[model samples]
Target: MTERESDVVIIGAGIAGLTAAYRIKKLFPKCSVLVLEAKDRVGGRTYTVDLTAANGTDKWDLGGQWVCRHQHHILWLLEELGIETYKQWLDGKKLMQIGGHRIKSHNSNLPPLPLLSLLDLGRALDKIENMVKQVPRDDPRLSKRANEWDNMTLEALRDQVSYTHATRDTFDIAIAMISGIRPREISALHFLHYSSMAGSFENLFEADNGGAQEWKVKGGLQQVSELLTDKIGKENVILSEPVKSIDQTEETSVLVTSETGQNYRCKYVINASPLHCSVAMDYKPSIPLTRQSLANRSPVGHLFKFIITYKKAFWRENGFSGEILGNGGAPVIPGCDSGPIQLIYDSVTGYGNPALVGFYANAWQWRLVDLEVRKASVLKHLTEFLGEEAANPIHFIDKDWTIEPFNGGCPVNTATTSALSFFFDGIRTPHDRVHWAGTESATQWNGYLSGAVQSGMRAADEVLTRLTPEIKLDGLLQELDNKFPEPSSSSVRGAVVMVAGSAMVAGLCMFMYWYLT
Candidate 1:
């Protein structure tokens, strides 16, 4: 077995790992750094491939594809790498399949529903936004209702706040698209924290005007990581080396062993993979139970993303925006068999090739199904919503994050019900010389590419302080601060008003009950 020594060792060569290596090398040139990745390629969750063989000349991103102006870290990194981005196509009307039968087209961001259902959805969203403001980004458990919120499932909250079936179904669809799981599986507190970190809950799904899906990189999102690897130097990164164990028993250094028996000795170690991936490794003396429990409880999102290339943009020609969402028809209740597809968007390639990108509703149900069967279902659904032209596509490609051994799944891992309240401390707290650097550990944009960059910078700074005591991290610290800004006064006042309004309503109800009795 080969042995090597470095100032620091980073596990996983994803965006976070590559960013940490780049920051360390740029700031402290003298410090030796090494990056180890289990996969043969880089980019972690971001995977871009050329579609030339499928009658397309442009590259397609099969994973983690969207970004917006508000995601500062990802935008900043793109600027640093000289990468360009284009706005998503949002000029035409959008279509929604209601009650798994009727198709409706609308120009607004919201789907067409009954007036009462819309009002209920608006009220529920406002209440959720207010509650989200009450949760702290640093430690959610510190909030007054943390335990209460964490103990309750988001599904239960939905049922309580929403008055109509449409409202409840809408919330379920949003949850499925954002988290790849049903509302009942996630914690209310965890969902609130996730939304708070993303700047607001609405920003999580909006496609236009600075929303999360507002833009796409010119070449592909993966280019950012590839460029970062170039800057870090290829020799410093070793691929196909899955770390089997980490031992920090020695006072001066930590030892990391790979599946191939190769050992790496370093002063500090940064784990940049997903939470579950870290849990797979055997650690000397074992990590804290809180951390273990957190990893054990938190599960990766099951997302099956696919891209279909067509000769023409038929939806746009039909005055349709190429965006489609289906929730098993109008009263859109949540069920595993709702449909094969959940959401889709116009994904014209960088070279101007027409394409449609989307995800499946229930990944587990379709993960093992025949590929042709899945494709047939997707085309039939698209044709029913868009037009006969949707049935024909020049090329098709897809990636199931569930089948990936390295990542387990894509988008992000979520905190299960009660997991955050009981094990929040273990999410980011370092143990011995080991540091965490995944999107899950970030304070802002927690599951996006921006979060990955922010976490990498934070973890690298943690190592720098110990490696070089005199190193000035003023710039790095400033960037980190921008990511975890304090809540606005206006938001706090809104929360207060919401609380007072609830109290007044309860008192009036009690008074009416007493008089009637």
Candidate 2:
């Protein structure tokens, strides 16, 4: 094994790992830092690809892309790193396809379905908004209803709600695009907890000036990750080194071994990879059962983040905004089985490159379709919405995270229906000297860039505290990882499960009480 020593070793050279290394190095210049990445690239979930158009070649993010002013951590980092931002274009008419009808709207609001449908949407939103505040994100198991909600998927509850067909379709699209999983695939509490973390469900879907879609980095988001690698010194960030195991057998330090026989010994480790990838690494003493079960059961969402470049912003010239929402997309929620794409957005930059970004629902059927067939179907679908002018793209590029080797899926990974309730606390807790930091472990914007940065800083603080031994980092640590209930003893895996279809009426009724006051 090629052996080396460093102050800290981070696995996964994505934003989280890179940010942690950058922050720690900035604070303690003398400290040695090493980052190991499994993929051939640096940005974990954030990937920037180049496409040539009529005028010139432009860049688009094939992974996690958008950032809102509300995402404070990433926004602050952009400013510190000297990255600029541009507002997303939403000035023209936007289209929403539902069933056989097409609805047009000039704003980010839900489509103008029938009055009954609109009412259904409003009620569902209000009820969900109220319930969001009550569920604690750090440890959802502590919530009285956690055990009950985890037992069933969101689809089970959808049946009970008196939503108009249109409203239901809209909900499915929004949810699937955000988490990359069908509502029926994830627990209701998982949905509620995510909504709570983002402050509201609307914040997850809106493209308004203050919504999650507000602004994007001037260059591709991958530039941010690349800069971190540059700042930490490129030699220290090793790519294509899939970690084989981590052994902290001795008391003084921990040893990390890669599949290529590269060995690293460091005082502490910041495991910034997703839970799915982290669990694959062999740990000597083994991670807690609670964490192990969560990793084993967790599902990485599948999504196609694709972009089609055009000679010009053709939609804009035709008086149509480039935004397209597939509300009436398919009978199936998110309509992956029924349609080619669930959502489309304007990918035009300040530099005048014209393009349309599309996200296809990760349906099992979609994956089964041949790549050429998928591409042809997408182009045909665009023709129906944007006219024959959209029939051909100047350049076409798409990435399905499911196919990526090192990185399991895109956007973010999610907890299974019953996993979060049982293993929530262990998500960010340090196991001996091995610390965890990833978007999934973040507090504010879990699954977003903001969350990745927040978790990275939290892990850095943890390592710094242990090395210093004089200062109390608990306060900062607590703020980063929200205070959740800890297991009373080492017998970590408890027999706690959420009841299926058990608490909808009761939870909503409780919310009604808050609504009345």
Candidate 3:
């Protein structure tokens, strides 16, 4: 092995890749591991920006912000890292504005406006709970049931409930907005999966401090990436190196060439890139047809996020909870505030001064992106809902995930149920020296931060189990070097270096064995 070589070369430095590197190092200390990131920075979609410059605002999350208490993986990691999270505030009255009318509502009661809207919301929740119970966690029966549900659209389900025209326009559209897909376009199974992950509509609605409140790092989510990097060492990580092609030759050895022409040889390669982004990489012995098909069919959800800083919490003064729900049309912004973004908090809750983070979802946002007119439109909507005084936000920042080169979309949605199932199975099956470890590839918490970590750990463990011989030999060499450190001339340094190099090679072999076996 040479200086340019590593036992395993991981592509992407997002949470998934970083977690994989950390797990590999912890499990195989003797092995050499390298993490290559195409971007200048880590944290793929998890970003926090300072909005103080714009409006004397505090911290703002641009991507992947909220975490539910039931989301065990992310919560556990935060606990382990000693990261603090504040509950989002959602007390007071919530506005249910639709068809140009503002309807006030509470968590325990129906909105004061329309009976149809109330029934739609109630029926939607009941159906969601029933659907969630229908799908047992990790049940092999899921695939079969998914197949059945895949044949039906969300619109069809709504029709079964016999919702009125206005109710369908408001409530049905709202579901689509929350899921980032039109109700008619998304499969019913996907909705069930989302509901199951969320627990229930009531649980989803209730935030601890405010509304199913969001937690942020005192610094930023990027701190998690930094912590992982510190443990892996700078030498083992490479940035701005995009992998162009991967060649798996005889004996399970992989030759990876970057876009810059630098080549790296490794026993195993973990591709933690997003599904859509992976399509750009060339594989010598092409990936399975199923995987390729999945990649091609990958769904890119609507992309929209913004932060508005006002003179004060103006909505609060008006007896509003600082929360607004709407469909995207004449009334409510469909899928508005379904998550923590639906609930506004004092910008100072995490790390800034004063600002509110707003989130949007679904076809309405997709149409906005398609038209390239989100910023101005968002401003107009905010102004209308919060009044003209609250219209001119001091600071406004938005992230268009659709335009991201590596992440062709924001979070994966339910529309691509079949594609996701295929891709998940295909990638996890392993092929030669190639391994897959990404948030989308996880068996649990498939689209969350914790799933990414779990996938990384699984990939690392697989490698550790495969290359036992090399690891054992490297361990012995390391012991010898440590015991004979006093050698001055023709010293153990040379031997130690050799052992270090061999350990890396062994790590590669282990990865190959794990991937192949």
Candidate 4:
């Protein structure tokens, strides 16, 4: 194997890995950085698609495209990169499919549902909002109700609350949208952690002014990685170099081998890949059992993101914002055998191109139907939701994350049932000169691109201190978490009061959504 040496070597050129490399090269100009990636391109989950039908300028963000106003680190990075942001369109009414009936509503807070079901949904949201505060982002395992919540799935919670079919469908869609998995697949504790990481479920879903899907990059989200790569210098990053193994027994971790017969003898190795990918590499002296267990349990999300380009914003002309969601069919809930369309958003690009972006379905639904048949069914359903105009799109492209090479899925990796309590903490624990950085290891916005940036910055600090012992900057990374301090008892009570007061102002439909996700 061809051997080389560098001060620091980072594996995987995703946002996390690239960010770390960029920070190192920027902060310590003398230190050399070698970024080895499995894929030829950067921006792991944040990939932008080009659909110029035979030749017209049209692009779509098929991956992690939206950023929340609350994600300050990402916003800061955008500003530094000279990337501009634009707000999502919400000028018209939204469409919701309930019990096979499609209803359009102008309200942003509440979905159209019966009063009985709305009350039940309200109670569920309140419970989630209050309970999620108990889950600390740093270490959810230590929470008082960790065990009970871990053992039970969000599905069990749905049953426990005895929600109506409408409420159940809403819960199912929300969980699937967040985790990219069915509600039955994710544990209650895991769901609560997601809520806590985002401050609350309301911030997680809302898009009006300050929500997660609040803004879009002018060019595309992938531009962030492209700009970072440009700053780091093309020569520093080596693509198509999938790392095969890491030997860290020595003080310097003197050897790291790639699948293509390249060897790196570096002082420190920053493993910037997700735990799932990291554990795949052969490690000398073997990693801890907890690390292996966490890797085994951490599953990437299974989702298919599609962008259907239209000649114009047809739905907007019809007074529709192009937002579509539901539990199933409502009281008649649609099962896996029924259809695959889960959520659809009005994704009109910054260039004033008319398009609709949608999440087709989870892995389970994808398996139920063939691709061509699924496409046809989606168009038929879109026709039902919009009109005949939906059937004739300029071009439509679908990205199936489940089948993507070098990446089994999209969004970010998630902790499986019981894994968080037993083994998740060990995921970021370094082995000698080897360290970790990925969205999965982030305490804030764990599954988003912003989380990846945070983890990358944190890992850079870690390596900096290790490389220059005299620097002694131990708590630099902790500063990011300081802004998100734990909520005090009084604050929690005040929040509850505020939510109660909102319910008193608006109906239960609006109150529950304001209180929760």
TM-score winner among the candidates? Answer: 1
Q: Which window of ten consecutive residues has the lowest lDDT sum in model 3?
A: 484-493
Candidate 4 per-residue lDDT over residues 1-517, each given as its tens digit:
5689899999988888998998887778788889998987888888988875323766688888888677876876898899999988877777777665565464455777665666677777767777888898878887899999888887996777746888787777776787787777777788788878878866666675456788988888888888999999988889899999998778645589999988998898889887788889998878888888887877787777888888789899998888887442322124454455778888888888888888865445654556676677678778867889999888877878777668887777777679888887676888778889988888888888888888898889889988976755545356656666343333222443455556556786787898898
Tens-place lDDT per residue, model 3, 361-474, is 443333344233555656666665556766666666777676766776676534454554544356476767888888766644556675677667777766666755445322
| TM-score winner, 1 or 2 | 1
lDDT of 1 by residue, 1-517 (tens): 7689999999989999999998998889999999999999999999998774234478889988888877888777888899989999988888876553577787767667665666676678778878888888778888899999999899988887888887787788788888887888888999999988876777777786566799999989888888998999999999999999999889889999999999999999999999889878999969988888998988888889989988877788888888887674422123345567778999887678889999887777766677887787788778878878989888777789988869878788888888998888888899889999999998888999988998898899999998999998768546645754443333322433455466568889999999999
C-alpha TM-scores of all predictions: 0.91, 0.88, 0.78, 0.90
Q: Give model 4's clash tally.
A: 5
Candidate 3 structure, TM-score to reference:
0.78
Q: Against the true structure, whose lDDT is highest?
A: 1
Superposed Cα deviation of residue 181, candidate 2 (Å): 0.5
Q: List per-prediction Cα lDDT, in the order shown.
A: 0.83, 0.78, 0.61, 0.78
The C-alpha stretches of model 1 lying farther than 4 A from their native spots are 53-56, 328-336, 483-517
Q: Which whole-number lDDT from 0 to 100 does residue 36 have in model 1?
A: 98
C-alpha lDDT of candidate 1 relative to the true structure: 0.83
* Model 2: ten consecutive residues of lowest lDDT: 489-498
